[model samples]
Target: MADVACEISARGFLNSLLREWTGWSLAPAAEAEMEAGPGDGRLRIPLPSRGSVVEIAVVHRSSVGLHVFRLPFREHRAGAPARIMAFAEFAAAVAHEPAIVGPEAARAAPAFLGRVFQSLSAIEDALARAPAPGLGLHADPSFQEAERALRFGHAVHPTPRSRDGFTPEDARTFAPEYGRGFPLRWWSAAPDAIVQGTSRAETAADLSAGLAAEDPALDRRIPAAAEGRVLLPMHPWQAARLTLDPAVDALFRSSQLIDHGSGGSPWFATTSLRSLYAPHARVMLKHSLSLRLTNSLRLIKPVECARGLAVDALLQGSVGAAIAARWPRFHILGEPGYLALRGADGAVLPQTIVALRDNPFRGSGQRPAAVLAALCEIDPDGRGSALADTILRIAEREGGGAQGAETVALRWFGSFLDLVVGPLLGMQCAFGLLFGAHQQNLVLGLDDGWPAEAFFRDCQGTGFVREFLPVLAEAAPGLDLGSGHRFTAAEAARIMAYYLIVNSVFAVIGAIAIAGLAREAVLIRQLRRFVEALAGTDLPDKTCLRLLLDAPTLGSKGNFMICFRNINENTDVTDPLAHYAGLPNPLAVAPAEVRP
Candidate 1:
């Protein structure tokens, strides 16, 4: 029981007083220090700010957004006192949102607060039931059961999405669901037998080892590798929707073996690709960010999302090329999502792959500086020009110049974001930022005692807009381009922060963390350089303030990139195209290979 500290706004002060009429301790302590949790956790107030103060002035001069009060454990115990502090915060939050909680009714505050307490208790109790330390981040119930089946000799295979195929009686015998699922953990030997609970329908016949042997019912033996390597055949259903670029596909199919992991969203498996070049193997798979569930079922907008993703993937490829090209001496591998040396069977050799994770802000500890430097030295002219020209031509065929909706131009901007800003940012920030730019999306490829390379994926997380339709139409005839809308100063800043600063910076931090160094120094150094660079360049006022002030300090190494939200509409603000000024136009289109 930590000491409880609480704070409420002036508007909620009266509500608390009314509730405390029956007597409640609003303030527990006078003041307390705040402490940050271990590694990227929250920094919260350690003790109560005021003694039984329901409403008090916040230290706004020092804090931003919301005020935090530390709960003092010395005074507040688990029984009634802890409940009091928790309820106070909940009541204040509920009162503030009249639309959700409803207006102040005649009900007493304590009664209302008690209901919230009960709900919290229920949630906490439910959380205790979870198998892992954190909910939703670990294996699911199905995964657990599958592991059990494998441990016993039985194999489990999944049923296709069909109800009619299953007889009601048969379904009852196997829990109504059957299938080969991703193996979170592999089993070496099968137990003697599997015992079923009384509630489960009895399968009188003893379960045998070959149960998964293509039985008309269930098959649990999935496509696995021989000799610690498994070749997970990308289900034909999944391959049907992937980006069909020859280069992208070549890299994708080259994985020697794939093993399924826990399934929830964007189901994934581990790859032995890295094992070809490096000591430890790594996993490679397409990220499933857009795929989610809702109450309503409808046709997914695949073409629209895929187009954006394809463009993003290409841009990411371009960024990788720029880095590799700039520093030939460094071991730079350029694949779609990443590059690794694989054996003839498409299995990555462990020695060829780096076993390090990517972290951009490792304080004074340095990463493979060559990669970062190479990214910065990218021939912005050569690759950037070719991409711009290629996209315009694609837009033309897609009806670019025709005045209508801004679809063509928006799509082009999506590609542009992938190619141009993505590459440029990869240098100053590190290549991994192109991924989700969030901690979870990043992985470190360690080599020797250092981080060797940074990899990024999840295309949707990257941001770009289609404001350049008019510009493209003016340059290329017979193209459908939209009359773009100019964003206000504030709106532009917000978009940049959301897409580039906040989202992208976090990815770099994840990469930097794996370098095994204190992030503070790295973040400060990067921040200093980023701020200094942006200060000279013309940028929105608000964006500048956030980089200098609002950015979280945990692993933020200065802000390095500014996403062009209003690419065409606001192009004149800071011209990415201007970088090509006076340079020989190397992007002149050659005969492009057209697929039938």
Candidate 2:
């Protein structure tokens, strides 16, 4: 089962890679060969520049246009051996292409392969364990179940599960998919050495006490000798690595920083592995780690931490109230505060930083909110998606059979648009606020297998138009809307289109189609109707909607190219919008039906 899951993920990676890199064209001759062949057939991708053609056996073709290919054969030369290797091997072999290889691929390949292995192991573990019953659709599903449900990571990313620094043991112990929890390592920072953002709590100690209130064991662990110091919690792995830092070492030697080792009740890892969740608590902790996951190192930069606090403050003010009035179901999981230790040179320590995130699912009365990514995940058994099964069950309850399923799917899609897309556009047009509403960053509140509410999280990717600075300033006085968080109107529009439209909305539509619940074209037409209605309104900035309707191509982040170039997603670039490549606009291709 794990092998099957890994292979499916590999095919997805290849499909995304081919789409992004190399102008791979279908050979006329290869099409003829496929037609002539019996049963399943092979397709060839002609790489003219490389003077090689790659052949793949078609396993399954998804309705959404994602091809699942197996038994890939790379023909380097006419007489050379047609090597049949695993997907990771094939990726490494192909990385030799100047167009595909990033400066860091050579350094990143080993780590990428290691992660693939870890992903397979994790998948095997999941399959061995008994499946959680009923798609976890109770009034409240276990947080750990939702977190672990994401066996496979980003479908489009070449190395979705790759973590550079972790061993197999570490992967099992730390990865969210493994469902293991461990105590956080504790440190003591002198009062003067603590750098923190303003929150309901006045000091780092105050925040620590608030966190400890959730678990009495945590409070008991605080030593009397640490009375004058701020309690600092760190990921155990991060703590072990910090010894190599000269500045941190010097601070430890000077008594400004004291290592208190691991203590406190275990905090479970969330889908975003660095973020930990205490189910009983009202807050989630986003901690900084040095390990590389997917495109970037999982460390929280000082600027990002500050931006989170600023965004949280902005959302709590008049701007937030205006948005809430417009769409009450659209919730932003605010990152209210953060704490970090400063070095002797006054530099903020990235590894020691922790951001406080709101926990919306604290009580039993709250509707079950599951990560959207988890819903889209392919079950290890390969029977169907959790989302598809849930939709089918709902359809059965409503009536029965395929027609009923289609009705439920269409209705669910419409509600998703109302709860998620409507608020996203409202925020952009009304407040000039752009949310990074990618699948992993969104949690959908589910009631009877339908999307009831949409919750957006992770403020690091959130942005605002520079034109709205005055409005934001008035709403949240003294808040620093950093230049990095500010975007031009055009930039904001493009980003909203990519994150909210291309990644989030289109992704959900595609997932629905791929699950065989409904047609992609129908869902897309529904989306078109929704956007058209919004465009007709007197909203200020409907550029995202207008662009989606009018643009020949839409901007999509080039994860393959970004990874190849070793682009640090955390680093501030002069042109942040340049990371995208043009993807054919689905809305433009499939026009909405003209109304009478």
Cα lDDT of model 1 by residue, 1-596, tens digit: 11110211211122222211222223322332222111222212122222222322222210111112222212233242522344346344433333322343323333344333332332232223212111111211121121111110000001001122223332222211122223112111111111111101222111111112222322244412222332222322222333243432444464422333221212112111101111111222221211111110111222222323333333334543556685332222212222123344544322211111112322223332211111111011111111122223444555655331134333433332333233334332332222223322222232321233444433323332333333323343442222222343333334434334433342232222222222323333444444445445443233323433433321211110110011121123343222111111111111131111
lDDT, model 2: 0.72
Q: For model 1, what is the error of residue 596's alpha carbon versus the real structure, in angstroms, after optimal superposition?
A: 63
Cα RMSD to the true fold for all candidates:
22.6, 3.6
- Candidate 1 CA-lDDT value: 0.26
Go through the candidates in order and give each one's C-alpha lDDT: 0.26, 0.72
Off by over 4 Å in 1: 1-83, 87-300, 316-320, 323-436, 447-451, 465-493, 503-526, 534-596
| Candidate 2 minimal-lDDT segment of 10 residues | 32-41
**Candidate with the greatest TM-score versus the true structure:** 2
